[model samples]
Target: MAISTIGFDADDTLWQNETFFRLTEQRFAELLSEHGEHQVISARLLEAERRNLAFYGYGVKGFTLSMIETAVEVTNGQVSASVIGEILSFGRQMLQNPVEALPHAEETLAALSGRYNIVLITKGDLFDQERKLAQSGLGAYFNAVEIVSDKSADTYARIFSRHGDGPERAVMVGNSLKSDVVPAIRAGSWGVYVPHELTWVLEHEDAPEGDPRFRRIESLAELPALIAQMT
Candidate 1:
């Protein structure tokens, strides 16, 4: 239970990310409302996003492409240029939106920074992730920032090795049981799921309900005490 390093997932775990994505998506649906109902628009958009993930990875840019693709299909290729323009506008607005730190994100990081080698291991377009990290102002608390295209057990192994941290001496915290917790647990590190309300459906996975290496907390505020108990 001796954990020397703690890795955090940046998006939902550290700050308000999924909320923006959800907001943008709703606005996107509105733009294509004539083409389909809310449910259909959402489903089609998610389908586009899933397919695009492999090619574009994750980020505002990829999202913009998916929205364009969805709009074409939803509107049966008759979607006007104005609507396409509006969709691009939405993406730009999202990219420019100010990053808002989630509750206790900074305070908890400040508390952990001195005690552990803190790292931000998040998956997204590298530049966008870096931009958000820079905007967060909590970047100073982390020893390193790893903007990865994917999060897997092997990624964790490499990160731990690069930092001279062993799995037994490290832990991960994030909202996704799929991307953050499960992978870390499989890598022999402890993982904590700090659930965020607006998770993308694509990020959803059955929770690690009874995994011994996995833990769930109500908020980042509980992290320090949880780490203490684990130690």
Candidate 2:
């Protein structure tokens, strides 16, 4: 099948995102561990995030707030104000830093630009996404860039419908299984999972084995040739 449109995931899929989060998380873990075990703190933080999602939605700001909230709860309100400030500062830093594109990200997007209607379908803070895109320089290759609040089946459905590309003729390429592959397949689109070396645990999952519409690749560099074979 000739792909009418190709959608790409932003964060760790195209560039270095989780590394900053990971560094901040180590600090969070260290602070939280002062109150309890690492596992206990991690579980409580995850639960807090789940509960707050309805109110806070998604992104680093919400995540930073959740960390502070969890710290207070875990420490019985004895958590230091300095720790809270550090977390908030880290979130801001994540937004301000220059985005580093993944290996071959620019080259591959440039390669695929004219062959298909390229789109960036990513979820994050609006300002952060825009800043990253602007820094990436690959933004010029994409016909459209969408910064979604979430990437559910409904989100994919609306995006494909809006682009006038049906699922069978569309393919989603990203590193996240949660936000990229699973939802794309559920929306009737083909999914191409390109595993990044450092995947966020929240986004990691077992690959879909023996699924014709779902394909896995070692890296983004091989995508153009792979797409050629697929068609």
Candidate 3:
């Protein structure tokens, strides 16, 4: 089927996202250095993030909370107020961080926008995602924007159906195999994996080895040609 709609993931796929998270995590390890080894602190923090996903979903606020929780845990509930405050500061800085569009992000969007129904489908804190989109200066290219809580097969099915011809004629491009590729391919859309240098560990998964609908590209600059080939 000819592709009509293209779905894009907003975080590391479009702009620098996980880099900031990784930097903040390093800061977190430094903050809790007195309580535990950096590796242990990071592991516990990841655990907290995984455990709290149901309550906090995804984004900087949840990350901040997880860091706090980890600090408290590592310190045996004796984490200083000063350290907690510093962790909160880290989240604030992340929220305020400039949204740097990945290379070819705007160019690829521009190339596809008029030719296809371009939809931004991403999951994160609603306000933060909105902020980044507004800051990106590439928002004008999208025909629609979906700030979803999560990306599952059903989520893609509903969004693609609502926004375009549906999953059979849709393509979802992103950095995560777990959230962006696997589920999207399962939903019957072509899943294009554009690996970013610093994807979150939670978002890692093996690619579908034998799926014809699955494609991989090293950068967004190649997306336009890839789509052309698909068509």
Candidate 4:
């Protein structure tokens, strides 16, 4: 089957995302610097994030909770109430930040929208994702928008089915090889990785080697020509 539908990931793929979280983590480390060093705070936070992932899912809310947990543990309950408040403030700042599109994101979407049934399948807080989409001004390009809790093989398979594409007939394009590319390929779709310069540590994974359906490009500006060649 010829490729007819294309799914794009929202964060880091279409616009800037992880940078905000990265910046907020810096403030968190500073707030609790008395308790632990930067590396220690960061490691503790990552551990807390992993433990709370299933319960809190993803987004600023989960991150905020994880930061608080890390602060308390690192300080052994010596972390002040004022410091906790500051950590929460960092999360709020991130959520309130304006959506900024990556280089050529709008152009890439514009080029593809007319040619394929474009879909946005992103995982994060539903309300936060919706806010970002509305603010992005690129939402109009997509025929469908899905704000999912997780992006797994089943999720891609189901999404592709709805958009009327199978593994051989659909493409998933995003920044993370783990969340965006690998699962889509496992479900029989072409996977395109447009690597972001900075990504969250947890989202990193190795690309599938010797996978005929997988492609990697350095920029969104190159995507139109790539799609033209693929289809």
Top-scoring candidate (lDDT): 3
Write down the lDDT of every candidate, Cα atoms only: 0.90, 0.84, 0.95, 0.91
Lowest lDDT 10-residue stretch of candidate 1: 160-169
Q: Highest TM-score among the candidates is held by which one?
A: 3
Give per-residue CA lDDT, model 3, range 1-231, as digits (tens). Answer: 899999999998999999999999999998888888889999999999999999999999999999999888888898889998999999999999999999999989999989999999999999999999999999999999999999999999999999999999999999999999999999999999999988888988999979999999999999999999998
TM-score of 2: 0.93
| Model 1 alpha-carbon drift over 4 Å, by segment | none
- Residue 115, model 4, lDDT: 85
Measured on C-alpha atoms, candidate 2 has an lDDT of: 0.84
Q: Give model 3 RMSD, 1 decimal.
A: 0.7
Report backbone clashes per prediction. 0, 0, 0, 2
What lDDT tens digits, residue by residue, belong to model 1 across residues 1-231?
578999999998988888888888899888777778888998998999999999999989999999999999977889899999999999889888898999999999999988999999999888788888999899899998888999999998889768747777889999998899999889889999999988888888988888888899999999999999888
Residues 45-152 of candidate 4 have per-residue lDDT tens digits of 999999999999999999999999998899888888888888888888888999999999999999888789999999989889999999999999999998899999
Q: Write the per-residue lDDT of candidate 2 for residues 87-170, one digit (tens) a residue.
A: 788778877878899898988998999888888999978987888899988878989888988899888888976774777788
Arrange candidates, best lDDT first. Answer: 3, 4, 1, 2
Q: Report clash pairs, candidate 3.
A: none
Off by over 4 Å in 4: none
Question: Which residue runs of candidate 3 sit more than 4 Å off their true CA positions?
Answer: none
- Model 2 residue 53 lDDT? 80
RMSD of each: 1.1, 1.7, 0.7, 0.9
